[model samples]
Target: MKIIRVGEPGLERPVVVDDAGTSFDLTTLTADIDGAFLAADGIATIRRALAEGRLPTVDVSGLRQGAPVVRPHAVWCIGMNYAAHAAESGAEPPTVPVLFFKTPNTVVGPYDDVLIPRGAEKTDWEVELAVVIGRRARYLDSPADAARHIAGYTISNDVSERAFQLESSGGQWSKGKCAETFNPLGPALVPADELDAGNLRLWSRVNGEPRQDSSTADLIFSVDYLVWHLSQVAVLEPGDIINTGTPQGVALSKRFPYLRPGDVVELGIDGIGSQRQRLRPA
Candidate 1:
């Protein structure tokens, strides 16, 4: 099932999209889509409600689509997980996953305006597959155990500022990744069973021009392994988001000019849907 949140920012209401592409209001059943709801098997409850024909379809024509879930505990990211993306950035595939963090406040509605931080001159874009955790996971025994802990999948634009990330930060990427609106996520949160996360096509475009175009098939560290590996060091909790890296073709490789004010960026992953953000000065 595809789940969504719609309304003005911070006032979003949970919603579910039916097989026919119709959206049904889920506010009567849940206040918001967050860790608490997922931990309680909210998806299963929604399914039961649908089967009983107890939900009311709602018109969402003019509503703003908020990030599918509310503020998560943390937003974890895997860097250089994609072989081609690594090559483009002059790095080799890592023997272990390269993890990083984007402050939870960096997340915003998928279609919201993205601000180019003041004094930022090298802002860039990365289209990645984001994994949302559905349960607590710590020191998992195997990668195979990851499936049960996953809530679903969604799209994320891992917006970055190159100068802060590479030149002035003394090597920590988080300096460039945690700016407000740096992570634009969702249109919907699709359940794990509904997506083959290992092989979807993801891409990005700046003002209608293609930039990054690649597939998850090239990931050096797959979703399951990243999850299991992360659990060995940090507890992965419900509503924690993992951005599983990006494929080649970002402005960071010097293949395209970095984003500037007024630039419109569009990006998405197959099945998970897409998002558009207009750049503005912070």
Candidate 2:
């Protein structure tokens, strides 16, 4: 099952598309896909509604697709979670997860325009597997506790400005990550039960040229471990997002030119879905 939102930015209507591509209006079921809905067992409720044929079918033919979830209170990110990515950045893979943040407002519709902040060079793209928290988690006993708390999976383009992040961060990475439209997430949010994130082909393309091409299997820190580890330090609230780090193909390694206005970025993760964005000056 894929949960989605369609329409203009602030007026997006909640929707759900079944395996057969039947679109159902979630307006009667909930106002929007947010923390309240997920925490209240919204996915299960939607399943039951779908089974009962109780919701109306929506004509989403021309509706714009928005980020699957509302702006999360916290957009948590993991850095260098992929071994090759760590190496490319000139560092050894960490013995533990490296954490960072992107302000909640950075979340935008999957197909929305991405802004290249003025005077910024070294803007980069990262194709990452994003985990959405469905239940409040804190001090989880083990990685096994992560599954139940995960509401679903989605694709996130962890956009960055390498200069702000590494060169001018004063040791803080969020300096580069927290820009408007920095995070393009989802064409759909697939329920966690329906997919196995352990192994999936996730890749990225910039201006039609292949950039990042890798699998989640290469992750130095697995999904469950990152969630479990983070819960020990912060409360993983429903609707919060965890960007499980990007694979090695980002421009940060200096293998390719950084993003510029007019460039197009496309990212995809099998099963979850794909997203594309056109860059323009902010």
lDDT tens readout by residue for model 1, 1-282: 789999998899999998889889998899999999998998898999988999999999989999998999999999998888898899988999998899999999999999999999999999999999999999999999999999999999999999999999988999999999999999889999999998999988998999888899889989999999999999999999999999999988888999999999999889989999999999
Off by over 4 Å in 2: none
- TM-scores of the models, in the order given: 0.99, 0.99
Report how far off residue 11 is in candidate 1 (Å): 0.5
- Clashes in candidate 2: how many? 0
Off by over 4 Å in 1: none
Quickly count the clashes in candidate 1: 0
TM-score for predicted model 1 compared with the true structure: 0.99
Model 2, position 219, has a per-residue lDDT of: 90
lDDT of 2 by residue, 162-267 (tens): 9999899999999999889999999999999998888989999999999999999999899999999999999999999999999898998888999999999999
The local distance difference test score of model 2 is 0.94
